[model samples]
Target: MEKQILLQVEGLSISFAQYTKGLRRRNLQVIRDLGLTVRSGEITAVVGSSGSGKSLLAHGILGLLPYNASMSGEILYKGQELTGRLLENVRGREIVLVPQSVSYLDPLMKVGNQVRKGRKTAGALERCRELLARYGLPPDTESRYPFELSGGMIRRVLISTALMEEPELVIADEPTPGLDLTAAKRVMGHFREIADEGTGVLLITHDLELALEVADRIAVFYAGTTLEEMEASAFQREETLLHPYSQALYRAMPQHGFQPLAGTQPYAGDSYEGCVFAPRCPYRGEECSIQEIPYREVRGRKVRCIRPELAEMSGSPGKMDRSPDAENLALTERGRMA
Candidate 1:
């Protein structure tokens, strides 16, 4: 059976307009030429270090980008373009966001009311209690306010709110923050269950190890762009990975010796002509700094780097699948070899 694509983002770019020292306006491009897809029955995790625009990508998809921020590129939901009106209609029903900030919950309202969306009916009340209990929150949690809950409990509450909607697509931005290792794994397990039940989940996190435990595919974000997207299994072996940053991430894993990559990610507004990772990449050539690299396929994985020879050396040699246009950005050929 063919897996259904729930959400697709193609060539998405996000920038903010700012006033400089002389009050002159300038644009800070935070995300550039990013692409990824989420499919039903799978969790697609976007992993990157801080300042890589992972959170911004979530906000862009939810149509919640700040006023000063401008976005270009296409966002499609269930094969239809996501417009402002359409997003408004489906924002909380068909699609839901488990925001990174616990502050998104109402400080004044009782936790139960917020989760139930102010419904007094018996079904809503029973459902709310069930969700809270499922996350290990006590029955009395409903009567308490946001300030009354611990960081972990509040995080669980936020997850419950999104789950309450029975959403087809769940975008969780750093959902495991403030959680201990065991608790974090538990949270990820819940998302795995959601995916197993056929909901498309886009989990945004900085923890590569946790992502590997639950995500079907991992899209590596770097300097506000995606460098490589591959199956979570590819991460098990350093040599199987496609891009340098991804290989670096695998090396940084505790089991892999925690080898750190040198150099910091470029600032958001810093201009770059070619690959953003070129400055730190050991294999970078002169052309890497001047040529525009297309996001191409290598052994069925989506990678933005133009180093096909490196991919071939890694045993991924094959004809690349090209995107016809920016809009349909090569939806990863289903059932292809990972």
Candidate 2:
């Protein structure tokens, strides 16, 4: 049985036009060659640090990029191109976003009206009450304005709003930021239920542990592009992970050693050629810095690194043997830095 691809983002890039001193205009590329797929009946988690272009990816999918931003590549929903027209018709209906910020709620609108999308009909009102209650909110919550709600309450309200529509695809951007552990787990469980019901879920969050619990697969983001996309089960062992950055992230988890990876991610405006993770990678070589590394499939996982050993290895289960050449590259990098 083939899984249905609900949404596909291929070769996606977003750049913002900004003016510098002396009225000089420059294009700052914030996202480059970003790609991911969300399949029906499963959740695909996009895990990355803040400013790694996660929210921007969500916005790009919905054709909601800001005025100064220009995007290239294709965004497909249900095997059709998701353009402005299609998105305009289906944006809040077939495709929904549980945005990270609670500011998305209108201050002037009551919570119930907002959830029901300004409808006051008895059915809409009853449904609104049901959703609020499901999330542990009282029936009176619908009468209150956004300002009257606490931060955690607002987060739950956002989830309720997104769930109001029977969306085919749900893009949740940091949906559990202000939520407690219990609430966050419940939110994730609701998304899991949605996926089980044959909807596609794109869970964008910095919490890798939480993602591993709910998502079937994880696409790791670095700087502005994806470094690795692998099964959530692959994260159970460091050796099962493909990209170095992915391994670093796994090791940084609290259950792991909580080890920190050195070096900062490159700024969006900073121009760079070759692998974006090269500057911090232990096995970085001259080619890593000079050559354009292609995103390729290795060991059943997609990775952007072009290391020869990674290319040669099959998708069999075992520890990856670091090629002597890679070891030398690491040694050479250390020597050069010294």
Candidate 3:
């Protein structure tokens, strides 16, 4: 049976108003035309490098963007528009966020109070203890403050807190950064358990390999946009991935020669005429510079490249010349300075 769509985002764009030199105001377009779907009982991993707008997507969904930020797009929850009062109502109840930073936890509050959200009832305490214990945290951990816990313990605490509420959708932003390999895998296992029990999980992380371990679908995020989205199994082989950036990521893995992708991602406000990844793409062509690259389905996979076919014609794995040319180097430096 097909799982129900829990969350749907379409044409999502986010821009922040910033004052330039001499008080000149400009809009820094951080995320552009991003879209993804999360189905109930499935985990959708939005994988990317840092500053790829993964965390911003979570903040935008919960209406937690900064005051100067402006968002224009459709965010739907269970077939209904999620905005204004509706968004506020579901912000931390039906929809929960496992924030990236441990600073999100109150430093002054004890773990028990924080996890149960200030509810002092006996049932809430019992539930909190159970949740913490489920994540390998001991019962005595409840009396300690966030500052007292180690990084890995704090990460587990955040997950335990998010699970305190029976949320329909859980948006976890880089939830395993501070954890050891064993702890990270354990945390991912918990997410899989929830997904198995019908909770839609949108996992935001830069660790592509870790995401592949538990995610049902993988959405490859580039500079402020989605480059490709496909099944996690597509990552098993480079050819299965449709986009050059996705293939490059697969090749960069430790098991796949660790071939570094050259050139830097464009800054938030940098202008792009066509595909953003063209500077680092081995299969880049002249048409990539001028043609409008639309996010479309190519050979049953969703991709955002005009010349995805070129990847196949290029050659065997690890053979593509990814060395940066003079032009690409100049462009990368310009993007960094921007």
lDDT of 3 by residue, 161-200 (tens): 8888889999999888768888889888888998998999
Off by over 4 Å in 2: 308-338
Pairs that collide in candidate 3 are none
lDDT, candidates in the order shown: 0.83, 0.82, 0.85
The TM-score obtained by model 3 is 0.93
Between candidates 2 and 3, the lDDT winner: 3
Index of the highest-lDDT prediction: 3
User: In TM-score terms, which candidate is top?
Assistant: 3
Candidates ranked by TM-score, best first?
A: 3, 1, 2
- Model 2 TM-score is 0.89
* Residue 231 displacement in candidate 2 (angstroms): 1.1
- The residue ranges of model 3 lying beyond 4 angstroms of the native Cα positions read 313-315, 323-338
Backbone clashes per model, in order? Answer: 0, 0, 0
Model 1: weakest 10-residue lDDT segment is: 329-338
Q: Model 1, 278: alpha-carbon shift in Å? A: 0.2
Ranked candidates, highest lDDT first: 3, 1, 2
Model 2 worst lDDT run, 10 consecutive residues: 329-338
